[model samples]
Target: MSERITRLEEQVAYLTKTVEDLSDVIARQDRELDQIKRRTQMLMEREAQRDLDEGGSVPLADQKPPHW
Candidate 1:
């Protein structure tokens, strides 16, 4: 009976360690995901601003130079 208790204790310790390692890995992945999300949002906003700066619309053909 004592040997069985010892085995159970060892198993519990191993499982606890595994859970801690997995938790650390999950936290790292969450940080990486947050960074990617922020970067993507920044790039999208930059592109939108560029479009707005370019008048946000195209002109007619007659508006072109006489080179046509």
Candidate 2:
């Protein structure tokens, strides 16, 4: 019974450590995603402005595909 209890405790500790590691990974990915989102938004805005400055009545993003 004592050996079983020790095994269970070891398993619990390992699982706890795994959970903490995964949580840290998730947090880091969240921050990276946020940065990517911001950069993408900035690039989109810049592209829109450039399209307007170039005298395009329809922004490229709003245009239909040539196949249509």
My TM-score estimates for the predictions, one after another, are 0.76, 0.83
lDDT of 2 by residue, 1-68 (tens): 99999999999999999999999999999999999999999998888879789986667677799999
- Candidate 2 Cα lDDT to native: 0.93
Error of 1 at 39 (Å): 0.4
Model 2 RMSD to the real structure?
3.4
Compared to the true structure, candidate 1 yields what TM-score? 0.76
Score each candidate by Cα lDDT.
Answer: 0.85, 0.93
What is residue 27's positional error in candidate 1, in angstroms? 0.6
| Candidate 2 clash figure, as a count | 0
Top-TM-score candidate index: 2
Worst 10 residues of 2 by lDDT: 54-63
